[model samples]
Target chain A: MSPRSDTPSSPSIDESRRGLDLGSDRRFLAALILLGGTYVSLLLAMVAADLFYTTPGHLWHALGSPEIRYAIRLSLLSCTLTTLLSLWVAVPIGYLMARFEFPGRAFLDALLDIPIVLPPLVIGLSLLILFQTAPLRALETVFPVTYAVPSVILAQFMVACAFAVRTLRTTFAQINPRQEQVAMTLGCNRAQAFWRVVLPAARPGILTAATLAWARALGEFGPILVFSGATRMKTEVLPTTVFLELSVGRLEAAVAVSLLMMGSAVVALLLVRTWSGTGLAGVSSLRNG
Target chain B: MISLRHITIQAGSFNLRDLSMEIPTGSHTALMGRTGSGKTTLLEGICGLRSIRSGSIWIGDREVTNLPPGQRGIGLVPQDGALFDHLTVRQHLEFALEVRGWALERRETRSQELAEWLGLTSLMDRLPAGMSGGERQRVALGRALAFHPPVLCLDEPLSALDDQTRGEIVAVLTEIRNRTGITILHITHNRSEAERLADRILHLRDGRLES
Candidate 1:
């Protein structure tokens, strides 16, 4: 008896096998593309719904309200201050984390991550609890950080600075330490080398960090609400404005504020992306050389 | 003179031990060693870039082991030139003078003189990325010499060049040595470089120096 194949070995079968192979190769990719498209489309749809929910005239009128106007100005001013203060802390912390070996260095690094990982409401609660203590409470009597104008800026900075420090640390690490070393070898003191060489080299990272911190501060709601409370024309920021509008059953006003924030975020992201893309390209070329 | 007295440094897994050497003022000394034999570590230790675990360093009657690299008055030309990517050749030369608080006119004249001396006058406005390997090395050398440092440390300065370019750099080094009479502590693995450039040869093996 001759050996026999169990299945038919035909030309059409071979062609069908090739077709199946191609189909299998595309299946995972097709699934991924569909999933990604669905996610992006959902986000775009939500934004579109907000944009179309209110008439342009209603949005303009809502934005023109004195309360809304105050929220906008407060948000812009507090966020700007938060960004500057965050950068001031972030630069030194980032530099030290990147360049130094100190006692408790690992612990300090992990500590910096707490704000980013912790719930925003919890951060607010922590701040409130700290202010309830002896020294901080005593200081609060003079500074009035609790439920005050300064609290708006403070709450935003508390969260935004963690993000800024993370960004700047990565930036400083990407830079070659040899550049600083070479600068010092050329008769520069440590400060001179940092200002003249490392700072300029890290300009891109700095811009990204500042813009991101500002955007975060602009959108901060939980911490601001818990620490500062939403007072009309006082502690109200953009996010608080949305909450206040929603609470009063003014959905159009809430959507209008949300739309403004979304627009601001988009503009900030665009600026950051453009700046970082150019900055990183320059840094990489220099590093490669 | 540049002097190292029984210096020891630990860098990662490699340990450079008991490295004592002396280069008389205005003389060129070449350090030769195998790959991973701690030549660069020794050079860095002398330049105050690396901390010595023990022993001391001196430059021209001053004990400089405790001084910062800037205070030691030692110039270093690292491997691959290590030029600041953002700075032009002229800026690189002016950086040290600026740190030393040189006036604008003095900085300009010094930069011009060094640029002319290094044949970098034409390349003064170009960034390091736009320059060739030899050109970058020349710029590095000019920057190192801009402050008129008492001792210059060269860490395999020509190892990254083509033979022709290396020859050109060697010529430049010879010219610089003859013209400036600066004390040079050069690290190299090539015997021909040692023969051509060094008045004395110090060979490193297993973290020890043999002169």
Candidate 2:
């Protein structure tokens, strides 16, 4: 007799085949998780080392130094102001881009990201040329100073607003306007539905936009240096302070400022990660669909 | 009562032409149509989400054809439930109540009552994302009925659920209708769903209401 073939439809065989396939793909998944974890660990290590090496006494002494204090105060004030102003403008622009179908929308959206890709020095130089000129200089003179504090704000504002608008627009785009329409059918007018339905939905995106804009404004240096000279106590923000100390061979001072900025950034990152429920909600909504 | 006459709307390539139907007061009416049979477009036209070229929509004693969606007291539960993903189930109910300017205590009580009625008491603290499809539909239904509009419209509410969940939701919806006596216009492609839930059935084909 010919050799008999025993081909049983065993469930165990099917499961083992699936198990092998899964085992084969596990390496790629492990590599991705490991890479991400390593990147985060490196960031944490850098931050901890900088902050720890600078003793409290050193930081306390630096805090008393009028130049450092001025830089800290100015950075905080300007970044806060820039974040508020950018949000006021970005929210509406972002909402319009997300909700409406209009001419040049794609081009408008692309234009918003230009600042992110464009060099900060170039942005600073462009503003310097634009506002430091005859007609624009005349406009600038209405304020006490142009090439110092205000210029820093203006440059920071320009870049921060660009990021804010782009991030918010993406967030709003993720939300469906159908929710608002449904709210309307349930006896809500436009304003009512917007506040009760749409705004709440878009809050996470708005918050993310705020955080990113604040971070960008805080780290701003090249633009501030080019447009607003790095005059200590006048236009010197944190990053510029770091650069000035480094150039003067005051490595300890530079490290201290770096640590401060790092702490601020870490706090911002934690806040974003912890309270980004809206972002999480939007992501889940997309996944559900 | 709500009535539509000769409603025509074109969105991109999809066209609904000469559609007409009537939803009587205090009756649950079902609109059965295949996908792209203009079921949603027709519903949107009535709610003013879509502008119609030629049509008359009357709600109660008023002609609301040209009124904005908010001005028409028509409650709509979309396929997605359209619940604000950021809001808690309780907040979703209160959002409508607050918009209608209901007193705070009343709004709170009403939300509580609705949460209990829909068996959503345990899930009241959760967002739409945390809920199952059936749970979300119940929440959306509760939100729509919170303020008690003159008429309610449900667009394929059960189409997204599994068979077991679909049966459970249909029973819940039926209970709601029986309790409130609110007129409902439910649009669905599933004939079995229509048979199980509707008091009357109207079919749509090529944008026209068929006998």
**Candidate 2 deviant stretches above 4 angstroms:** A1-60, A133-135, A282-289, B85-91, B105-129
Model 1 residue B62 distance off true place after TM-score fit, in angstroms: 3.0
Off by over 4 Å in 1: A1-32, B12-14, B189-196
For each candidate, what TM-score against the reference?
0.90, 0.85
Q: After superposition, how far is residue A74 of candidate 1 from its true place, in Å?
A: 0.6
lDDT of 2 by residue, B66-143 (tens): 998877887889887877877898998887778778899999999999999999999989978757889989998998
Model 2 Cα lDDT, one tens digit per residue, A1-289:
1111111222332235432244767898688768998999998898778877788887778788899999999999999889999999999888787777677777987888888899999999888888767888777667644566878788899899998998887666666667878888767777787787778777888888899889989999988999899888888999989999999998888888888887788788776675565475564573352
Q: Candidate 2: what is its chain A TM-score?
A: 0.83
Q: What does TM-score give for chain A of every model?
A: 0.90, 0.83
